[model samples]
Target: MRTSSLTGVTPVLTGSYTPDSGGDGPGIAALRLDPTTGHLSYDEVEPLPVSGASFLAAHPSLAVVYSTNETEAGTVSAVTRADDGTLSPLGDPMSSGGANPCHLTVHPGGEWLLTANYGSDTAPGTVAVHRLGADGGLLEPTDLVVHQGSGPVAGRQEGSHAHQVLVDPAGRFVLATDLGADAVFTYRLDTRTGTLERVAVNPMRAGSGPRHLAFSPDGDLVFSADELSSTVTCHRYDAATGVLTALSSVPATTAEDVANQPGGIVASPCGRFVWVTNRGADTVAAFRLAGNTLEPLGEVPAGGAWPRGLALVDGHLLVANQHSGSLAVLRVLDDGSLAQPHPPISAPSVVCALAL
Candidate 1:
């Protein structure tokens, strides 16, 4: 694997998911990072007419970016990236086929885009797929797979709420995490047709509410961050067969309280450590791999409240704090511990950050 060199790393993009009812936040914020000093400076902000521009994904090999307009009537939009790291609207937004589309990912081959719709009163949670034109514009959805079933939890798990959809590293399978169902559903991706076919369902502990998942560098292991239970579960992944077998589940926070909610999870670039964010606890937990198992190293304060997303860029760990509406940059030490080089930078309703 090629490691990122920190010498020239500069621009970072952030996505805000503020609801129209509340805060005044620009949809996208541009930031410049000083690689030598690990300091961040705000550059500019772009206003997206859409109410909730929540999550953002970059094209695999293009100067394009895609964002999920997370609202009651969900939509997805694309933007063109300029040479100086500015973005311009690509075209009109496209329907996501369901309400409150929360997460989206670009296929590794760059031919397809997939979104996980967190359904509302009038719709059911579904996974939608759209074909990408050569210019990176999103076409109409080719397929929508609506999920059924619920978990044991009340209120939160009243119905299926698909939160995230990610294509496996090998591009052979797509995994969708259903927070309301407490399951990770696997699908066989038909790349030629931009469709999804369910192959397997890996159920988590009842009320676990699995949200986001990360695959190990070798693609043999998968880790899921359970939002409701504040635990991280390990699964053995068969890349060829598209099967996930649960191995173990561990708490993300050391606190005895059950109120901590986990948000995003990621594996270290070197695959030596796994990290997860705890919302109520306002901490990021570090766990080391021990032969398919995770051993907790410790947890550090996330520098603000509600760390929703995490990204590793230029030897730094960037965290998007939602409630606090700030971006925290921390130096990632060799031992996998985080050290703050500067105070958190301000950005309203910051939920997702992408390093470019």
Candidate 2:
């Protein structure tokens, strides 16, 4: 087990894109988050020796962190965190059953680890459900639900590419966003049997290409960051029936001619605001909650280039500026707007931030 020099400061784990994934990065690293200033401390680890760990998720009630290897022969691995801030592999890596596994989430019950395999041209994107060990290790997969279909968009929409997989707040359904298919599929997980039952396939705009989704604080709605169209769409979620109905849509960034690809999205805990990161525009746009709809609250420079991932913690927003290889910090304002961004912290190909 390797440990970073984290003593007085609280640490936040970060995932990065490595050379294997066409990125120049140090794989996985540890950074610090200051509760008072809402700024990040420029402390990185002797980076964990993992490859293509482009995204990461922590177990809800455990000290284990999970990562998708995100390679041609996709794999998943688990690492346990020690009390002294050391992290060790829980077990040997296991095949993800498809290529380019991009996103994953631990079931609320903590019994399963789910992955969204964003397959390449030869492989179809699939959702794989793996049984979780008592210690949060990834075990054998119980199901691999492959997505099928294509959208009107060219190149990116040529095949089925599942980008993100998340379990609903209710813990009754698992929703996977397929950007290539322009659809969001809802599935009911049979915990005892370790299976996924396809419940609903909600279609987005013909070529919206939804990437990641965030639930409203109230859990009554889901906000999707549409990558191809650069729009944010609101969907009314029916928790009872596991159905999602598209309600409205708004441009992720009103900035004209930017050709932006909307990436990460986050909703305020108070339900007062929602923020979406625009890559090409290099901005983070805000939306004010007006009754059941959203009103544009303007945007702020993302503080770095290619802001691809975001995390909102304690009134502060952290943007993973992928192309620029840095992490930018933005303060969340009371009126649901963003203040000027703070200085960017260097981190090679930083793609995602997970609170530790």
The digit string of per-residue lDDT tens for model 2 on 1-356 reads 22335544457778888888778887778777775687787553367767888789888788899998989999998988776566678999899879999999999888899999999997988999999988888888999999998999989999999999998887889999999999999999999978999989998899999999999877899999999999998889999887889888888998886789999999999877899999999999999877667799999999899998899866789899998998988999889899888898998889998877
lDDT of 2 at 204: 89
Per-residue lDDT, model 2, residue 219, is: 84
> Largest lDDT belongs to which candidate?
2
Angstrom error of the Cα, residue 232, model 1: value is: 0.6
Positional deviation of residue 227's Cα in model 2 after best superposition, in angstroms: 0.7
Candidates' lDDT values, in order?
Answer: 0.84, 0.87
Encode model 1's per-residue lDDT on 1-356: one tens digit a residue.
Answer: 11122446577778886657244568877777776778888765454444577888989888888998888878888987676556688888999989998899999988899999999755678999999999999987899999887988878888999999998888889999999988889998898888889999888889999999999988989999999888899899999878888899889899775479999898986788898888989888888988878899888888799899988778887888899988888778888877753689988888888877
Give the runs in model 2 whose Cα sits over 4 Å from its true position.
1-9, 42-45
lDDT of 2: 0.87
